[model samples]
Target: MVEPGPSISILAGGVTALFAVFLTFYLRNQWQEIQSLRAIQTELEQNNERVRELAQLLTGDLQRQQIDLPIEVPPGTKLEIRYVVSFPSSLSTTAFDQLKHSGMFLRLSPETRRSLFELYDTIDRINRLRQHRERIHFDDIGNVHVVIDPSELDVEPDASVSEDDLSAETRRRLSDLREMRRAMKGVNRSILRLIASIASPEMIDDLELEPFLGTAHGREAGHESNTESPRSDEVDLEEMRSILRDVERESVWSRFM
Candidate 1:
């Protein structure tokens, strides 16, 4: 009728109680992590749009540039600018860094865990993108001054702009910028979804966690916080170029991968 199982040797005196205590501690830690993730989700939600807007602003700037770099330009006595892409300084991974480094990452559902990794990986990619753009801007600047005559306005440099227009490198940089914007949209979108799922976890492990989390408040279901879709879905060039303008301000500079 019933299946027989292997016999159990009794755990030593404090061993059973120790395990119970540890289980309680682990649940408490998980609750704390839920809070931390919500914080990250909030920060990501706020910044994602800003980052996306910034990237759009950048592509416009690049197109408007008489010299988008990744090309040689006559260093005419003209305007010089250094564009820096910026986001709110509020976002930080310190909490995530700690939890991930600990046993906590193993506590999440496989899907949730994977999503977390994806969110942060994109962040690293964006940082690299920023650095790459900066390198492209600064590295060739010194060389441009060294080789070209100062009389031309780059437009007037030999009395004209390049007949070829944007060089291959410049085109590649614009592509990179759009890709970066898509990535930023992803971070925002994914984090929102994740936090929603966490708020109302369906995994068996999460269900079992309820008694421990009974006192903890959970967020209402947030299936679709953002009504607008990710900008990645669009591939329209005419629309993209409409906003094209000068890159003299700090608002533009483009993407990574």
Candidate 2:
């Protein structure tokens, strides 16, 4: 067997050292990336929890109150309308803001970055809705009631509630609240999915919301696909639908002092 030359031995040692250095740096970088993901996951989890709480508050408290449009207040009863909204701006965005400002967010894959942006964007949208809701103002349609009574509820609604009454500006505020509530629910669901994706080894594409497409809303939204038959349980979403007095009669009550 031929003996190796000194020059060959030196070259082999140099290559081995270089490979070791590269592997060390590669592993360190991977560890750091995991740490960063954990930090972001923590912030997103908090955002999800808080938004879920807000959704619940709206769903529960709104059940106790009712403000159907063309709001007719009988003599001596008061109409009290209150919107309990939790603004997202108040929540801490430290981790997310840091990620964005440091350009770390840009480093993520297209699907991941898009999901993260969507999560934060939903929060921002709810905040904007809350702000816009407060600005909603309208001229009084008729007598304004400060409080409501069961006897007041018993009075027959004026059959002639006009289209203009249904379109009153005051109702816009309530509608905005409804939007915020819906967004709050959806955001948490997205966040949960995002969190799950983070822990998952496989990368995910964007999630598409497939709302029930068997109602008038389906046609209005321009969805060409329609169901041939309704499901045993059905739900619908319509912002402009004129279903008057949708307040839960069994779950509603009002008080005044």
Candidate 3:
């Protein structure tokens, strides 16, 4: 019979080789997981940036809407309401898809996962609303060039055409815009909270999102201060006229076309 010592040595060597192979594969998998996590973190930061930009854009639009409250078509003016749709960043989902497909997204705490889903869902809703709004504005109505001859200007706009008329598609668009703005604010807060929870301290500092998340009351105070000084009807009307004049001078449609 072969010596027991030789047989034991061969078995030990085989075991060692098998262990090495397993270890190598294990380490490689761990490294890949780490890389995936880093990618997810980076993507989250980018999504947050996009969300912030959307928020700022929506805020500006809402402010303009406020300034144009009680929208009116001036007499002898051709009111051209062009649809200028802004798309959200396309980078929002590629990394997220990778993370999900890697099966590592499941490793995140349930709460974090929920927050991420909520944020994405809100973004999807915003996108859908934008698409619908664009369709309604551009396709359904065709060009929104409303020619108000001087005669029509003096005449009160048709009750159906009034800004307050909920039946009016323009009113619906404004309503949807306002809703989207509010949703974007909530999304911003969610993104900030998620970043605060998941981001490394260094990463957080690099992102420079602390100011936006931390200055809630200050922002509110600033908004109040800016809007609290009530303007006269004359001023408001003048502002609306200015906007209309600008719209006329720079046809939004021409730029897009």
Candidate 4:
């Protein structure tokens, strides 16, 4: 019954040991990555908190001064500001244009202000939904495929016959490999989600909501963090306006404007 050059169990043991080593190294690296990401996320949250504080301070200063010393305007204050905010071609950019064109930023009547705020809140909800969809899922599939080099293996006819005898070990190793692949996929998904969340096209419209995205603090934080640039999600509002103004002078938007 034992017609084999090498003992089946012995070979199986060796393969199992090799698989264990690979899995151990892979898991160790994954744990380190997760730890690193957690730290970066914490720092990002702290930076965001600081940004909120800055916004509050600026708002308070404006409010306090407004009450004590009202702003002086000329006899007929018919002020009109026109500008463009350049954005990368993305769904978020389209959404931002739509919202801006909707007169959301204009000084509207009291009823319109309430409606704009509601619309703003709805946009936020949509953004959150998109982020949630981007999260890691265990069963997720990727388009990229990995090809194993079967030519690297030196297989003898006898080795092939004994493979069935070591079926238990083979099954175990294969299962472990499958699990490892799944775990790695999850990690990759999470990383992609984080990147997407920071630079997601859907978040473009949020820039015009209340607190502008990519402020000085955000830019500094982006430079400090390895994760994302501070202006990763924002359209350069002022710069866009300047470019459009120049374009207008060149008669680019003459037909529309």
Best by TM-score: 3
What lDDT, from 0 to 1, does candidate 4 have? 0.34
Candidate 1 vs candidate 3: the lDDT winner is 3
Off by over 4 Å in 2: 1-36, 60-65, 69-92, 103-107, 134-145, 148-257
TM-score of 4: 0.24
Query: What is the per-residue lDDT of model 1 for residues 1-257, given as tens digits with 9 covering 90 to 100?
Result: 53343223244436778998999897766556555544444545444444444344443443444333433434343333333444333224555576576544565557555555555554444444444444554453322211222353225445433324444554455445445443333333333222222222332143232322221223422332332212222212221112111111112211110
The residue pairs found clashing in candidate 3 are none
Model 4, range 104-145, lDDT digits (tens) per residue? Answer: 224234643343343333334333433432332212432222
The parts of candidate 4 lying over 4 Å away from their true place are: 1-9, 61-257
Question: Candidates sorted by lDDT, descending order?
Answer: 3, 2, 1, 4
TM-score winner between candidates 3 and 4: 3
Q: Give the clashing residue pairs of candidate 1, or none.
A: 176-255, 177-255
Runs in model 1 lying further than 4 Å from the true structure: 1-31, 68-92, 102-104, 139-257
Task: Please give the clash total of every predicted structure, in order.
Answer: 2, 6, 0, 1
lDDT, candidate 4, residue 246?
41
Clashing pairs in 2: 78-145, 78-146, 78-147, 79-145, 79-146, 79-147
How well is each residue in 1-257 modelled by candidate 2, as lDDT tens digits?
A: 65679778999999999999998886665455444544566665565455444444433433543443445554444456554344333334677676665434555657555555655554554444434433331121212323333243434454332223433454565555445444443333333222322221211122221222223333333432221222222111111011111211111221110
Better of 2 and 4 by TM-score: 2
Which stretches of model 3 miss by more than 4 angstroms?
63-86, 101-103, 141-257
Q: What lDDT is reached at residue 19 by model 3?
A: 100
